[model samples]
Target: MKIGVLALQGAFYEHRKMIEQLGAECIEIRQLSDLTSNRFDGLMLPGGESTVQGKLLAELGITEPLRNLINAGTPVLATCAGLILLAEEIEGGEKPYLGTLPVAVKRNAFGRQLGSFEYTGSVGDLKDFKMTFIRAPIITAGHSDEVQTTAVFEDKIVAVKYRNQIGLAFHPELDQDTRIHEEFLELCKSFSLNK
Candidate 1:
């Protein structure tokens, strides 16, 4: 199966490598043309600065198409800033988001870039994953009761998965372990067969 990673900014290349490691063809999506022409079973939006990523995505005219695809039940794995873009509302950001998930996010919730951290945790479907967080945005709230909090930090949710969508406030792609990617591959496989 083919998986597309948003390569506009941030650790997109890292995500591409991880996805490729999962035995799936990887597509680096930088332009709207890529989104239109590519046939992907799943997509990953890597961690980055949400405000900048949002504006950059707008400039590329991919925000809407991505939102549409996810709404149509396309398998999506979003990390950090990518998670922020998927939220329905951001606590304090003027930039528009893709609004694919029913959650509220607080940008830089983990504090500044210097306040970044590396923690060992069980990321639900993928256990014992060492997650790296750099200026991460935490999911402050989820409107739907169906939203399942997958991982937590000090009792605060850091990762969640609902249906075909998964969001993480940490960088799973940055880790050497391919379990996260493999789990996403399973999500892709299920989504593809069911769709």
Candidate 2:
């Protein structure tokens, strides 16, 4: 399967490495032309500055197209700032970006970079998953019924899934564990076959 990792900002290369390590083709999506040249089976939006990524997505003319892909059933795995991008509503009045996932998010819910920490807990069906948070954002409690929360930290929601989109407040790519990547690829493969 071919996976596209948005390279406009953030820890995109790490996601690329994980995708390749999991035996899938990885494509770095840096421009609109890149999407035209590739029919990505899946996508990865890595952690970074949400503001900068949102700006770049607009300036690069990729915002709508990418959102269309996600909405059209192209599975996406969005992490941290990426999670903020996909959120339908962002708390504190930050304008939503893609709005493909049916959820609300709170940016930097765990403070700033210094507030970052690691947690090993259940993510979806993956038991004992290692979650690395860096300037993370949390999926707020009140969201649409379509959103199925998959992971939580303390008493706060950290991850959720809606349709073909998987949004996480932690950086699964930063950790050494391959379970999340493996699961994503399987999801992509399943989607590909059905298409």
Go through the candidates in order and give the clash count of each.
0, 0
Native-to-model Cα distance after best TM-score fit, residue 108 in candidate 1, in Å:
0.9
Off by over 4 Å in 1: 93-95
Q: Which numbered prediction scores highest in TM-score against the true structure? A: 2
lDDT of 1 by residue, 95-195 (tens): 44898789998888878989899999898856678989999889999989889999998887999998889999999888798887888898899888877
In order, what lDDT does every prediction score?
0.88, 0.91
User: Residue 131 of model 2: what lDDT?
Assistant: 92
Colliding residue pairs in candidate 2: none
Which digits, one per residue and each the tens of the lDDT, describe model 2 over residues 6-123? 9998999999998998899999999999987899899999999989999999999999999889988999999998999999899988789998887889988989889989999999
Give the range of the ten consecutive residues with the poorest summed lDDT in model 2. Answer: 138-147
TM per candidate = 0.96, 0.98
Supply candidate 1's per-residue lDDT for 87: 91
Residue 36 lDDT, candidate 2, scale 0-100 = 75
